[model samples]
Target: MEDWYYKVDEKFLICSICGYHYDKYAEYDEENNTPFRVEISGGYGSVHLETKKGDWIRIYLDGNLSAGELKAYKNVFENCNKEKSYLMTYEGNGFFTIHFGNPPEHFLISFKEYLENLPEDRQNDVF
Candidate 1:
């Protein structure tokens, strides 16, 4: 397992090896909407999200992501559209589908720079 640490000032959970930073709180309130538990091990882990219905949903991250992808995730969380509801969905393999507005405007984003550096066979393989 890689040694990881959190940066309080920036609210980032960073990977020591590649220095990739994952937004700790991202735009969610720590007191309420934040992930209750985040377990990162061997470069990948799960985030436990509390739903509006009071159910806990465990979302897994494969840990293969580029800086752009992380930034996009943060941007989605930090920005508020005029729409009353916004949903961000992790579509596995570092892709995210963001929906905004009542009728919903969809956006798909993923950064392949990091993954492209890996061997061709390992590029799409998840941890």
Candidate 2:
């Protein structure tokens, strides 16, 4: 229902849930005083997100994403309905690995349309 961001050092994120970093994202929980889970781990260039509740999520770019792609993905995060789907930037570039469990196939179709509706600048980065 709310989104927040924070700058985090590399050591803060851990993959307790997945047991590994996916290179594009990672997450940590400070309430427990340790990492509760991490996403998109084991990559070079990473994007970190921290919530007001002291929870952290990060995506490691690993040089797979270009400037333009990253820009477009930022747009997606700003525009898409976060409640309806999950997005991951594990491989970087604008190409997101999305998971939509609600009405699964329908959500995928909607996501595809979301991409199609993007301006050319954003569309090109999806690989």
Candidate maximizing lDDT: 2
lDDT of 1 at 111: 35
| Cα lDDT tens digits for candidate 2, 18-99 | 1234331235656555644434434433444444445545454444556687666666545444443233433535333542
Between which residue pairs do clashes occur in model 1?
none
Q: What is the C-alpha lDDT profile of model 1 across 1-127, one tens digit per residue?
A: 1222444333435432222345433344655656433433333432333434454433345554466865664464344333333334343456444433232221221234555556789755533
Candidate 1, residue 113: how far the Cα is off, in Å: 39
Per-prediction TM-score, please?
A: 0.21, 0.22
Query: Cα lDDT of all candidates, in order?
Result: 0.40, 0.43
